[model samples]
Target: MDQGLAGLIGAVVGITGALGAAYLAGRGQREQWRVQLRRDTYGQFLARTKRAERAGKAVRLAMDSGRFEPGLYATFAAAVAEAEESLALVLLEGPWSVASSAEDVVRHLDGWRWVVELWYDGDGTLTLERALESAGRDEDRFTQELEQFTNEVRRLLHGRDHTLTARLAYRLAARHSA
Candidate 1:
């Protein structure tokens, strides 16, 4: 074999190897966005749930203080809306179960929104204590369902690991008294 030809062949093989390496690296890098998105979706889910819970608390506090301010209450209502949007996006993005779970999130946020709105804009028709009681009950039910929904998402995404569920619980628990 000619020495020059051998060297040429060796160079080609080296170039091909480099290209293959680059291709694989690019593939892995692409998945980095997926991993980050998944993380963001989960983080948003937790944040939204916590925000909804806080909004409910705010409603209770406002009613107790007898302060009727629609704009102030709207902030909490807006959080519920933001939470709904995040859930919707998560459903649209991936892992399939986001659809079902995100629906649950939307439903819960919707019900919770009323309570926030009631705090500021509710007519004198219904008794504050009664309405607050009803909202609290709804929150309890939705919280249970949200836990289940997120658990399902976690099960689908993480298999046996319950990291998503745990994080959500930790956030809710931390804010329980708040």
Candidate 2:
């Protein structure tokens, strides 16, 4: 073969290899960005839901104590609204399973809110004990749904290594709490 032809062929191969590598690297980076985006969205949703749960607890406690604190109820309603807003993002970033679980959590929160509203407006028709019991059931279901959502997120983010991811997440949570 001619020397010039040989050099041209070598250059073409090198250029092709470089281009392929660059393309692969770009693809990897884009995937990483997407995963990060999803993680952020999921975290926001979880945080908002937790806030709503805490607010609900506060409202329930006040109600149980025979205190009709309208401010607490307002706070709880605001928190639930924030959580619902976050749910839209979760749904947008979801793989269906995670979104579905998130939806369940929101639904339970909404149910709890309705229970609170009914109890407040019951005017003695709805007993406090009955309302508390209903709220407890709603909370339990919400917690289970939240756990399912977390598991789905872990499976999606960490694939088959969810146990390891769970441990890491726990550690991070513990660290942050401290």
Candidate 3:
């Protein structure tokens, strides 16, 4: 992903995890939930992160070349699948307490689906400038949404007293440059 989006997302991780983040809170202790959520959230992060990188790479390829050809939808499909699976896990595992702004995640999924539909119509004929504009707009919107959701999650997670998992996330996040 571009530095703008990457920085945006890194900040978001701290912000969202603390926003009463959606968590599987059945009979487990809060720490347990936090630990599990840390892992799950990281997995979700990796999937979306890769998707962002792939989309950015595809755009660059198209821009560098003369034609609009790079598997946009195919890459987006992986992101869609990750989001769907996360939702499913949230639904199936326990009563998911939604953090504020995560509803936007669902909205992003819808927007991505629209992007896929646009791609299905044949991007070869689409103007490269127009296509890039569309992609940049979509990426901006979704990244904003993801940033907000992540801020919420960070808020929820970091608001509590430090636990092993929380400290681990903190250390890991600290290891990176802003």
lDDT of each: 0.72, 0.87, 0.55
Q: What is the lDDT of residue 60 in candidate 1?
A: 68
lDDT of 2 by residue, 66-167 (tens): 886988888988999999999999998888998999999999999998888888876878788999999989988887777778878988988853655555
lDDT of 1: 0.72
- What does the lDDT come to for candidate 3? 0.55
Sorted by TM-score, highest first, which candidate order results?
Answer: 2, 1, 3
- List clashing residue pairs in candidate 1: none
lDDT, residue 31, candidate 1: 79
Q: How many backbone clashes does candidate 1 have?
A: 0
Which model is ahead, 2 or 3, in terms of lDDT? 2
lDDT of 3 by residue, 1-178 (tens): 8999999999899778755355434435777766677658645753654454355446445554655444655565666666655655444433244333444565665564565456547655665566666756665666565555555455555564334454465446434512
Off by over 4 Å in 3: 1-35, 38-46, 49-53, 60-64, 70-72, 91-100, 109-113, 119-127, 160-178
Task: Write model 1 residue lDDT over 1-178, tens digit each, in one string.
Answer: 9999999999999999999999999999987877778778877876787777776677667767887566656777787778777876677676666567667766866776675555446686667777777777777767766776667666755666675766677566857758
Candidate 3 backbone clash number: 19
TM-score, per-candidate, Cα-based: 0.71, 0.89, 0.52
Q: Report the Cα lDDT for residue 55, model 2.
A: 86
RMSD of each: 3.7, 3.1, 19.7
Ranking by lDDT: 2, 1, 3
TM-score: which is higher, 1 or 2? 2
User: The CA-based lDDT of model 2 is what?
Assistant: 0.87
